[model samples]
Target: MTPAPFFYSIFGLYLNSNLAIPGLIVLPSVSKVDVQVSFNEFPPALQTNIELKQKIWWVSRYKDENDRPLVTIWQLENGDYWRWEYGDRTEFIIDRKGTQIWANWPNNLTLEDTVTYLLGPIFGFVLRLRGVVCLHASAVAIEDKSIAILGPAGAGKSTTAAAFAQAGFAILSDDIVPILERDNHFLVQPAYPRLRLWPTSVKALYGEEDALPCLTPNWDKRFLDLTQPKYKFQELPLPLGVIYILSDRTTSPSAPFLERIPSNNGLISLISNTYANNLLDKKMRATEFDLLSRVLAKVPLRRVTPHADSENISKLCDVILEDFHKLSNNV
Candidate 1:
């Protein structure tokens, strides 16, 4: 059977994949989809196995310079080779060029589970291979400004962005936010129209915990479906206004607040918030540092601590908007 190609757009690029990607926007044939990939029976494989050093693992169980490994990398004679054992009976093999990914899974495994992991961190790694500076952040467009919300896991980057959505702000991207440099400016490229949220965030936003569909069947995490025509996702690149690194209230003062980060510290924070940054090699790290230097010099950066309860997200949004205007007027 000749499987018709499925076309979608994401991360400011067109994608033509062999399988249907749910929650992705389909475009006409005349539309441009730059990157092409396929999920077929067999893709070209390495002729021979070379030495592979354990780059990263499924879990950081130990730190003895070498130990248990899950996701391993091998510099094949032809190109880069990656192997992932996701433990859900799902596995993946990705080529060096970031153009192809081969998935393997147990027969009983749900398709949702396979696609979830594949698209999340696995595909983020592929984007890293393609040299996109992916950030662990979410963004919203306000007054034509791309305000990126940066934070570590559980820091409410997506949750905060979802609040912006509830407040009638258009979401730009969530989770893996890709940034591109063009014409001497840093631009936050628009991604797909989906925002993943936890049960608590879903309930807080929609008042119905189970209103939206799960990101994957086995996962409790739900996502905002922008395809409904109601939630409009920003579709073009916008020059970044500032990257607000979020801090938990437990570690912050009583009330929500924002603080300016020194340029040097901002550079460090930028590197720390980068998506899949741990996988960067020495050369890649050097390039990343250079990019960060330029970005920090050009774009504004700040740190924000939201109220502990997190119920009144509107207040936090108000503080951010106030500061954004202050910064913008000064600039």
Candidate 2:
């Protein structure tokens, strides 16, 4: 007998897939499915589609031993699907409608490696196609509202969320934050219940690097399990209360500091840190700009500069919670 598909909900969409996403929380059974994931074989339509005018859509910053881009995308002329190639081992074809994904990978390539690509950029691209404005940020629940932690890679977005989780706060999302506009408020859609951290971060948070299990055997990165009793994962969408842009860590402060950023600068930061930004078209950029402009009018954007000392992480979380309290009292 054939095995049943796995069911999960993330970024407010019900996912039904033949391949189980390890860190994502699984649901028993769902009546509605928003996205379907298939691993059988590549669809014929992808090969038959004519090349679009812009055949090459994106290239990863990372490179292979041959010095070529590790990941390259070929945007099909058919406008029906986008093909993503990661290294030489894995490839995924995503439909333009964001409703289906077809994936292929060699057995030599660890399943975790394929899942790393799927759960990160692949799913982020799907959310973009579905008209959700996504940010390269992490979100955590504070009181009744959500706080979005925005930064480039290595800027402590996930680390900050993990720190909050250790303090009993609920993590709304990690890495890619999906934003939805409803009436006058912008809400945050939760991602999976896992936080990927560098070994250094794990050591800082848990007293040792081995405190959490390695995300994959080939990777030194460890992941914090939010499903564990001590941690929390927020499932419901919460209204965004603030956006905190993390600046470079400094040594002088010995503590994290927060300041309100100018609206113009905040908008620029939002555009720069948007998820799957390299693949967005002019129309998508325009929509994102408009939506974020309105969000700035209501939600404040602040800059946070943290101490370089990894041990000061708890102090960082304390500063953010205090800021949230002030924001709440003012309202």
Candidate 3:
């Protein structure tokens, strides 16, 4: 059956797809506890399951969602079928086509993160078959250009990104940003509207008592809802600009510093910062490597080591912005 079209704008990368299954069409709800989702492929099994539940929130589990099995896998005739449930109200089913992803998500929640996670592998398959590339980094667009934050898990990538957002800098993505080659230039898209911060970090940013509302209840991570209208959450895509690689030096008493590095060096540093899940197959790793290499070649990279001081977030933001402005002027 023909499905209704749902439009999603992530960092300016527009995706228009249908949000319907065989007997079910998931629509966005106005409730705050509602779930948003997207799917790449729709399998009959998924349709049947959703039809049975009628309304429930289910996302990928992977120790992220109340320890529930977030991802459901089913073997299909053409390829493997994967479904991601976001809590109890949203879900997405994908058909593992070599190049195309029959993807769709709930309109209520931003599907940026879900899309970015799948885009890497989906695009990787396309690029390897067609010889293209992708990267593992966080990107934001400032002044119509995209700037990426690259680093390891413990690195302050998300923290820095949140600081920038607080300073009125529009956040393009939190953990992942897809770099697509268009018109002989690179275009970055937003990955999600939420930033996952550690509870302690959240306390530092919003204050211990203040950050409580943002906490994910029993979860260890605190989610900052950038989609709040007050933040003026931006959905537009910006051009690619600067790349900052984060490092933690909180144990030291020194102030934060930003070091400019050659493109090759920057690329290597980014490769080291990638967060790879254990379930990712070899093909996924190869694809990640290719994408990281391509991104490094196109953008200027910097290493940003932020001091571990509890009060250094604001200061770190200022220092990074100064460097960004300097680079902007030189460019």
Among the numbered candidates, top lDDT falls to 2
lDDT of 1 at 136: 88
Compared with the true structure, what per-residue lDDT tens digits does model 3 show for residues 117-165?
A: 3444433333333322334566655666778887776677777777777
In model 2, what lDDT does residue 26 have? 80
Residue 109 CA displacement from its true place in model 1, Å: 2.5
Candidate 2, residue 294: Cα displacement in angstroms equals 0.8
By TM-score, the candidates rank as: 2, 1, 3
**Structural similarity to truth (TM-score) of each candidate:** 0.87, 0.94, 0.66
Compute the lDDT for candidate 3.
0.57
Better of 1 and 3 by lDDT: 1
Candidate 3 residue spans exceeding 4 A from truth: 4-6, 11-42, 45-93, 98-136, 209-220, 227-230, 262-264, 275-291
Query: Which lDDT values do the candidates have, in the order given?
Result: 0.75, 0.87, 0.57
The parts of candidate 1 lying over 4 Å away from their true place are 1-4, 30-33, 46-78, 251-254
* Model number with the top TM-score: 2
**Pairs with steric clashes in candidate 1:** 14-33
Instruction: Quote model 1's TM-score.
Output: 0.87
